[model samples]
Target chain A: MTDAELLASCHTVFPGHKARTPAQMFAAMGAWCEEHGVAHDVYGSGALLQQFEQKIAALLGFESAVFCISGTMAQVTALRLACDDRASRLVALHPTSHILVHEKSNYQLLGHFDALQAGDRHRPWSVDDLAAIPDRLGAVAMEVPMREIGGQNPSWAELEAIKAHCRQRGAHLHMDGARLWEAAAGFKRTPRDVAAGFDSAYVSLYKGIGGLGGALLAGNGPFVARAAEWFRRQGGNVIHRSPYVVAAAMQFDQRLAAMPGYFARTEWLYGELRAHPLIKPNPAAPQANMLHLHLPVSRERALGIRNHLAAQHGIWLFSRASHAALEGTSVVEIYVGDNLLDMPDGAVREALTLFSSALAA
Target chain B: MTDAELLASCHTVFPGHKARTPAQMFAAMGAWCEEHGVAHDVYGSGALLQQFEQKIAALLGFESAVFCISGTMAQVTALRLACDDRASRLVALHPTSHILVHEKSNYQLLGHFDALQAGDRHRPWSVDDLAAIPDRLGAVAMEVPMREIGGQNPSWAELEAIKAHCRQRGAHLHMDGARLWEAAAGFKRTPRDVAAGFDSAYVSLYKGIGGLGGALLAGNGPFVARAAEWFRRQGGNVIHRSPYVVAAAMQFDQRLAAMPGYFARTEWLYGELRAHPLIKPNPAAPQANMLHLHLPVSRERALGIRNHLAAQHGIWLFSRASHAALEGTSVVEIYVGDNLLDMPDGAVREALTLFSSALAA
Candidate 1:
C-alpha cells in the first residue's frame, strides 16, 4: 500500500496532535458560531475578532492585541515597528530562529532589517550571548522553546537577564512566542508571566490550539495600533476573518488548558524512549511538548522502519527523518499532543521499542 | 431601531450583493468541499489550490497563477516583481488607485518603490494619460473598470494604445483586474481577451465569485514562481486555504456566466434612471455591472431618503452617499449583482423614481 494509504489506516499517530479533516474543522467552527451568535469582521474589525484579541491580550498581560493571518506577518510587523521606533534597522536573532530559517530571510529582504546572529544554532541564547552582540540593535527576538534544536529553552533567569540587557541597550525585546504556550507550561508559569517583560509577543493560534490558522500579536496600545496598520499593509486584513477567528475562539481555551498535560506526556514519552540504546533525544530531557530523537541509522532505514510500524503495527510515527548533526545518524521530531495522550498506555512505548530493534538490526 | 437592525430585517440589499452571514459561508464551503472531496492545502500548496490556480491562469491566458490571501498582496507582489525585473524602483499609479488610496502607501513604505501619479482620480485613464507620464517606469498599473470612478473602463482602442505605449517604454503593464469579469461583459469580450497583453493581472476571487476572501495573480511562469515566493514572504501563505479555494471554485463559473446578464440589466436600469430629473450617472451610461449615481442632494438628504426607502418601501438601495465633486450634490454607487438581478422587473426603476422625486422635493 502507498504511504498515504498506510497512514490513513493507522489506528494511532504519535506526532503533534490528532489531525482533523478540513470538513470536520469547518463543521465545528459553524457549530461554535451558531452557539455563540458570532458576528463577521470587516477588514479585521468586529466583535468576534476584537473580543478574542482583547482576551488574548489580557491572557498575555498586554494592553492590546491584533489578529493576523499568519505568525510570519505578525512577527515581521512587530519587528518592523520596533525597528522603525528605534530608528535603527538592526535586529538580533538566533541562527535557528524561524525568521532566519523558515521565512526565507524576509526580515532582511522585505523588512529591510540588518540581522546579527546572536547565538549558536543548537542551544537557546543566554544573557552572555546577548551581551556579545556588538551593534546597537533596534530589537532582539527570542523564540521560546526554540524548535530547530528540539524545543530547548533557556532558564527563566537567563530570559530576564536578556530582557534587562535589551533595556540597557534601548532595544525592544520581542518574543517569537509561536510555541510560548508549550514553553510556559514547562516553566511552571502562566503565559502572562512568561510574556511580562517583552515589548511585543506573537503567538500562533493553530500550532497548539488546533484551530484552522491565524496568529495574535500583543503589546501596548500604541504598538498594537501600529501593528494593525502593518497588518493591513501585509494584506493580513482580509474582508472576512470569521472562519479563523471562530475556529480559534472555539478551540483556544480547551487546547491551552491541555498544554500542561501534553508536556507531561512528552516527559513520560521521552523517559520511555531514553532507556532504549538506539534512541537519543536532544536536550536530554523534555522542556516542552516536542523534542528530536536521534537514531544511529540512515534516514532511509529509519523511514523504512517507520513505514513498517505503520503497516504492520497500525501505529503512525514520524513523517520523515532528516540527517542529524552527528555522522551516520538521522533525527525525527516528535511533538506530544492529544494524539499521544489519547493512545492507550504502553502502545507508543512498545511501537518505539520495535522500531528501535529494527534500527539496531 | 438601529441601522443594522433595519438592514438585517430587510429582504433585499441592492448594493454589491447580498451579505452572507459567517455561518452560512462556512456551511456553503463545507458542502462544496464534501461534494468535491477536496483536499486541504499546506502553506499554499496541494492539489486544491494548484488546480484552482491553473484554472484561473488558463482562463486569464497566462502561463501560471498563484493564489494569495488578498488582492492587496497579489497586486503588490506583482508590481514588486515587475520593478525588480527592470532593476528600477519607479512605478506609476492612478491618483485613485487602491494601492494609493486604500493600502496606506505600503508599496512605497514596504516595497520601497517610487510611485508617480499617472492619471486623474475622477475618470479612467486613457492612452494619452499613459503617454503623459514622463518617467521611464518599471511598471504601470491600471484598474479595469476602475471602481473609485464608478466602474468605467476606457475604450478598447485606448486600452490597446496604452499597452503599446507601455511596450515602447519598456515598462511592465499590470492590470488590477478586480472587476475584470464585469469589464469583459461590458467590452463584449472574454476574460482572456480583456486580459491579453498585460504582463501580470490580479483578480479578486471573492469580489465577483462570492467566495470567502482570497485573490489570484496570473502571469508567465517565472513571474508567477516569483509571486509564490513573495506570497510566502508577505505571509499570505496560510496553512489551510481549501475553504477559500472550494468556495471560489464552486461559484466562479456560474457567477462569470451571469456577468453579461448583470451588465445588461445595469444598462437597462441606467436608461430608466437617466430619464428622471435630478439624477445623473457618472459616465452617462452603464459601462459594466456598476455605476455611480450623482444626485442633486446633500449627503444627509440622500441618506435620509435611503433610510426611508429601506423602512417604508422594503427596498435596500445605497448604504451611504459621498459628497460629489459638484456643489450640493452627493454620489452613491450601485453595483448590480445577484441581489439586484433577482428583483422584479421595474421594481428598481420605480423605487429609484421615488428617490428622485424625494430629491426634487
Candidate 2:
C-alpha cells in the first residue's frame, strides 16, 4: 500500500493523533546526517544524538542530554545511574510506572533494582504518600502525568512536597518524563521549571514530537556523560543512526515548539467532553494533552464504539481493554497532540456523538 | 540541508561505485516502508513480531527468527540464552569479533560470557586453532566473513572441522553473520548453506538489504522463542515497528535473491585487485566482497590515499589505523557491495590508478 493508504488506515485505527509518517521522520533524519561529523564516540551527539538532545534539552531546560532507543531504556538507565551502586537497590515509584509493566523487570533482572510502591498508579503522590513508604529507598522516580492512571497529575504544591520528602531522605529524584511535555502545559510551567525537581528526566521525542523513534535522558554533565557511556555499553550505538536522530530533531524544532497550542486545543476538547452527559474526563481537569474518557457502556460496548469510529467514521479513539494487567483499570486514555490540534472542534464533538450513538444502538 | 543534498554530498564523497547512493538507500527504504510499515520496534522488529520473524527465518533458513536493534544485542542476547545457567561462560570467537572491539565487553557484562580467543584478529580460525584452546566452553561464536579481519572466512573443510570440534565438546555454535551476504558471494553458497554448521545465526537486514535500521537473529524454535521473550524483557519490543518489518521483508525478497550476482561481480573485482602491484588482497582468493589492501605506504600515507580517493577521485576506500590500540601493523578493508558492483572495471582500475598516483605524491 502507498503511504497515504497506510496513514489512512492508521487514522482509522488511531484517529486524531497518530505516529509520525516515514517521510516526515526521514526528512528529520536527513538534516542531522548533513551537519554532524564523528570519528570517535559510538553514540555521540554528532548524529541524531546532538540535534534531538539539543532541541529537547533547550525545550526542557536541561543542562545536557543523552538519547537511547526507548523510553524504558532511558528511564531504567537513568535510575540505575542515579543509584550509583548504593546500598539500596529499592526505588520508590508509583505502582503504574512503565518500569513495572512495559520494561519486563530489567531493573531487577539486569540492574538489581526493586520497586518500593509508594503512590497510587493513577493518583499523584503527596509528601504523606511518600513518607508512608516504610522502606529506605535509594531513589524516587515519579512519572509526570501518570499514564496508567489516565494521565492525571498532582498539583504543584504536591510535587514540591514530594521533592522535600526525597530531600529529607537523601534519595535521588528522577522524573519519568515520557509524557512530560504534556504535563508541562498542565502545570502552566515551562518544561525546564518542571525538570528542576528531578536529578534526571527522560523526554520521548517520538510521543510528544511525532518523530519516527527515539528518546532522550537528560541531567547534569556527569550523569549524562556517564549515561552516554552506558548507552554504548548497551549497544544502543549503531552505525549511521543519523536518520532516526534527524527525525527527532525535526519533530522537536517543527512540532514540539507548537506544544502550547496543542495544550490549548486539548483544553477546548477536554472541556467539551466533560460537559457531555455520557462523556467524562477523569480528574475532571486534565494535567496534560491526555485524559481518561469513561463510558457507561460495558467494556465490550466501548470497544465496539471505538471500532465503529475507526471503520466507518474514519476517526480513531482508544478505549481501555476490559481486562486487568499491571495497575488494573478499564479506563482508556485519550491523547491530543499537534496532529489533533488542526482537527476542528466539530470533529471532536462528532466523535463523541458517534460514541453516544453507538452506545444507543 | 535537504535529503537530496545529503545524498549528493555522500555521492561526491564516495563517487563511482556500485555502492548505494543516499538516494538509493532512501528510495529503497521508501519502497520498504510503503510495502511493509515503518514503526520503530523497540525490540528491533518492534511491533510486528511474528511476520518479521518469519521473513527473517526464511531469508537465513532458520526454523524461527527474532529481531534486535544492534548486532551486539543479538550476539549478547543469543549468548546469554545459549548459556542458560551453564557453568562455563566462555564464547570461543576470533580475536577480532565485534564483541571484542566494537562492543564494550557486553558479553562479559550482560551475558557474563568470557571470550576464548581462537585466532589472530587478522586471520580466520581453523579447527586446530579452535581445538588449541584447552578450556571447556559454553558456546563458540564465529563471524562468517569476519568484518574486522577483512571479511576473511574459513574454508569449508575447516568449517566442517570447527563444527565437529564444537559438537565434540557439546558447545553451541553461533554465527555472527552480520555481513554474511558478502561472504555468501565469496563462498558461492546461499545464506542458508553458509549458516548450515551453526546452532544459531544473525543476519543484518539494514546492511545489504538497505532498510532504515534493524537486525535479525534466527535459530531453532525454542531458542528463538526464548530470545523473543528476552527481547521484550529487554524493552526491544516497540509498539509499532511494522514499517521496518515490512520493508525488511521486501528487501529480503528482492535484494537477498540478487546476492549471487553481487558475488560474481566481487570475484571479477578480486582478480583485478590481485593483478595490481600496489595492492595485495587479503586471503588473495577473495572469499567475500571485503578485501584488505596492503599498500606499501605508511599508515598516515594510506589514510591520505583514502582521503584523496574519496575527495579527489570520488572513490571511497578505508584504511586501518596503526596497532596503537592492539600492537599490530596497519591495514584497511575495502568493502564492495551494492555500491561497488555498478562501477565499471575501468573506474575501479582508474580509482587504483589514482591510488597509485596519490602514493607517489
Instruction: Calculate DockQ per candidate and list them.
Output: 0.68, 0.31
Error of 2 at B282 (Å): 1.7
**Chain A TM-score per candidate?**
0.97, 0.87
lDDT of 2 by residue, B114-191 (tens): 787887765788898888888888889998888776678889888889888888888889999888887887777777
Error of 2 at A299 (Å): 2.6
Worst 10 residues of 1 chain A by lDDT: A19-28
- Off by more than 4 A, model 1: A1-5, B1-3
Interface RMSD of candidate 2?
A: 4.4
**Per the 3 Å backbone cut-off, how many clashing residue pairs does candidate 2 have?**
28
lDDT of 1 by residue, A201-244 (tens): 99988888887788899999999998888889878878888778
Q: Which candidate is the best by TM-score?
A: 1
CAPRI band for model 2? acceptable
Q: Deviation in angstroms for B301 in model 2?
A: 2.7
lDDT of 1 by residue, B1-361 (tens): 7676677777767776677777777777777777777767877777778988999999999999988899998888888889988998888889889999899888878865778887777778888888887777899999998988888888899988888899989999999999999999999999999899899999998887888788899999999998889889878778887767776888888999999999998887877875686888877777889888888988988889888878987777787689987778899988899888888767777777778778988
